[model samples]
Target: MNINLLKLDFKNIRDFRELTIPLFKEKDVNTPFHISLIQMPNGTGKTTAINLLRSIVCGEILEKEIVLSYQPTRYKCDEGYFGVLLIIDRDLYSLGMHFDYRNGVMKYETSRPKEVGGGKSFSYDLPPYIRNVMTKNFTRLFVFDGEFSENILDNKKTEAETSIKFLYFLDRLELLKIKADTLLENKRKSTKDTKVHTQQGLTKLETEEKKLKQTLVDLNKQLKKFKEESVSTSQEIEDLEKKNDELLSENETIQAEFIEFTTKISSLENDIRNGTNIILNILRTPSQFSLKMNDKLKNLSENMSKLKLPRSVSSEFFKELSDEDECICGRPILNDSIKKKILEKAEQYLAADHITTTNCIKGSIRNMDDYKELSNLRDNLYSYINEKQQLIQAKDLLKLRLDEKDQEKAEKIKQEIIRLSSNLVDLNLYIQSLETKNSAFQEEFSLNEYENINLCQKKLIEKRKRLDEASDTVNFSNGVSLFKKMMDNIISSSIDKIKEDLISKSNTRISQLMGNKDVVLEKIEGCIYVDGKKGVSQGQSLAVAYAFLSTLFEDSPHKVPFIVDSPVGSLDLKVRREVSDLIPKLFAQLIVFIISSERNGFVEGIGKYEDVQFLTIYKDERETGSIAFHTDKKFFMQFHSENEEVQV
Candidate 1:
């Protein structure tokens, strides 16, 4: 598996957006490392660097490359909530933590810019259960532990509740069945929910002139029948409900067709690999403009090199010659005329040429390659703009056509009013039976009714909760907030339970890994804490964090690179030994940031690992950037030299 790095030049950052920008530029390393350790003293801007890398992996922001910027306030505080994203081989992803303060409200997004647009992208914003795959996918996220651990214990119940939905999400078949069941129940209940009232059917009135009109001939007979028997308004209301259902069904069918076509278009877009979009623009554009400009500049330089005249054109002799010469074409050429035409022209040409203008290449600056690249980028933006406009227009036109058809359909129903009224009554009683046949018309692929049904199920529960607390007074105030709170409770309860289980299990593993340490996890109002009452140093805290993090990568999907700034901060020999093994055990590539004094034993432990790599970063006298001292790891092949410090 090839590793992609998000490198920062450090000199170009202009703003906070740059911190959460992107880096896809890559370089080859001989190392088979899955982890890259970086050490930058407090002032080195490490946090700003990684966050920018995260935005690129997330793909939530930025267009193509990282734009060095610092104006976070200018983009609006809410805009800074975006994160950086970095992509790895296979389907691995890395996203930077994003935090933005807006007015009095603070917003935190789940994933950064680069990782967005996936159907799974929303998983980041969704409650915990929805974000499991993301949480579990990357192997090294486990290595990161901050004060947030305190929140986990503090909100165990809340965490568990959030985790429950994730449990359900994992069970796709169960979720599917639940969705179908909910839809079936909803359809069954709706049949009974509708009621209609009418004093009587339009009492068909017929005149003596009805006999002349065949259509009205039956009107009087129908009116006489209504007087003979009163039609039940309850049943008529039921018929109206059935008619409502039919209309709803038709609407659903139309929506389904639209969605099907939309999906087809999406598939087609992917198949073309963006060729359809840029093909026309690329074909129309030419790079000759740039090349021709370069040629003109070269010619100008050649002319300037040989532009000087002879040094011996004496004024006395030239004057005498001009006066003595006869003008064969017309008259004696005057000395003043000679000076006016030839000397003046030469003088102006020499004076007009500024040193800078003459010395500088007169060619247009854009190279052929630059023009080609810009042309392609411009075409892509233009095509997307044009395509979106077309789609919007088409959607509007389709809506208009559908509206027109709907009006026409309503009018058609008017002509058969009597017959429709009779038929609607029968449909009220027959809806349940007709709906049973829906299962028999299943398509080859599963229908997406589950999404609609799930929505209805949520709404139904909400309505039921309100109805239960329905006030006796007819003018009772609506309980929308109460219903919302109830829903929030249900959702919270489900996830909290799962979060609790994860923390508990993960902590259990951490304790086991610690072996003889007596560190306890603390609980607070909002966060879970790992505190060592018996003097826990900052270095110890980092080690504890590493221990806690290892459990997270037990069976991770992506073999991410593990990076530790200071792996054995304040640990004793024993803790370092365990950490040495743990880092390599958890990640495919391990990079340990050491302070030179802590190298021998740590390197020995990792040297046995298959693809481990290491390097030491220190100031160099000759090089502008930090020099890297390479070790045996293959990744540092570029920096490897016989001399210990090769100024690399």
Candidate 2:
């Protein structure tokens, strides 16, 4: 699958009243220019263009506020339009979004190839494969801005993992598993409701399953809402603290003490957060945290080794022997008593499924390290708790001093802070309770199985098994289970391979970009991280991000255009040149939104390519619209914004 950008059109949107910029060369619609550089100054529609491109490709629903934000500022406009023309594997398509500012409504329109004669439709009419692959998350990978560089490195974000899953079709495999589950469910529903007692059992189980499913859904929604509220509340608290600091700036004596306490409290809070993360990571491996579990696992492993639990001969061997005409000692097994005895003894050995499970457990236990880490884990947990206690004390002392200086204002702020803090604590505790898995020591924490996703899923599976047995669809259920397991194994191995390859390729490119700088990509779990570094400069971050994304898209089956805003604006001269030279070769088409400030080294490097198109667009000072000038490299390099403002 190949997607090439041909042109973009805008009307009554942002700074552009009417505009069209060709993304390809003259007399070419089938093939896009290798490099199409569009230079736009600050206050122009560069950001709006990027957003519209993403919306068109992914068919995202526009919020009411977002739709109104695109209205033209120069004059009254009732509506606006943004359209994108592209070719997907030789088929021409045009996607358009019409925004009604009055009603806060946005409608989509799609035009297919002339051969199909499907004039215009008020919906996205893309092919199934294209729709499936061009998800919002995937679209953001190609159509993005410099902020994405920071997002790719943030540990809380899953941008790197999501890109791999979507680009490599692992998400599709997951969807197939979901479909299998749905099919099995339909089979259960279609079973004959013959016996009243058995039907009642199935009904009860189905009702319980539905209730559990709804509970899971509600819990997920609450989790998302709480997370959003957490971020907003934290920001609000920070803003209020800054305001308090400004109020205290009038009194030097008190201000100095306040600043000192604030700084220490902030430091302690950060330390607590980091410590909590570390403890959570340790808890993910329960055996490393509990001595009792460690000893039990070790004992189990040793006993399995001694007893040869899986055994050298399985029950299948005995069953085959029972079917033989004679015994191994040359005795006549034609005797019915001898065959019956052999068959009866076969039940004593492990079946194939049991053997496989035993082997897996044995391997897992054998691979675990000795219980030395338990002590270290305990120490870490203690240190984290100590830090948390210190943080609370510091916050309380700060409030006390604030109350001494200004009672009325400080009292109000302190009360608000306390309320917010309590809310945050409750949210955090609930989130942890919902996310934690069941363990042997769950009772110690009074963990409820119904509140936890993992435990609820386990109960759901058990109920499903009972229903399957009642419906006499055990064979079908087993087949679906096996298929799901196979898919899981394939997806896991594929992701592992992709992660290994991406890390190697990204590090190679990072080295090339950084030269002698010791920037090595150490891992790509939820996000990309550098070796032995807490953070990198903005330039280095951008370089690392480009390296990662270029490698990610290099071998993908879909050849989508790389459309980026300020691709090299944050980069230094050397990194800008490196990125410019490397990025064009990794994608089918490159459409970069740049301001005049990024033209020093980036334009020179990219201009070296033969198939490059340069164009400049900006707001017209005398008119109520914008102007698009089809220019050469000379004009593009020299042009500057009239206001001399730099786009961030």
Most accurate candidate by lDDT = 2
Q: Candidate 2 lDDT, tens digit per residue, 524-607?
A: 887888663545655555557677888898788887888989887656787777667767766668899988888777888888
Candidate 2 residue-wise lDDT at 508: 75
Candidates in order, TM-scores: namely: 0.32, 0.52
Residue 330 deviation, candidate 2, in Å?
Answer: 91
Q: What TM-score would you give candidate 1 relative to the actual structure?
A: 0.32
- Model 2 scores a C-alpha lDDT of 0.78
Worst 10 residues of 2 by lDDT: 192-201
Give residue 597's lDDT in candidate 1 (0 to 100).
37
Candidate 2, residue 24: CA error in Å? 1.2
Off by over 4 Å in 1: 1-32, 39-45, 60-479, 511-525, 529-544, 547-564, 567-584, 587-610, 623-648
lDDT of 1 at 212: 24
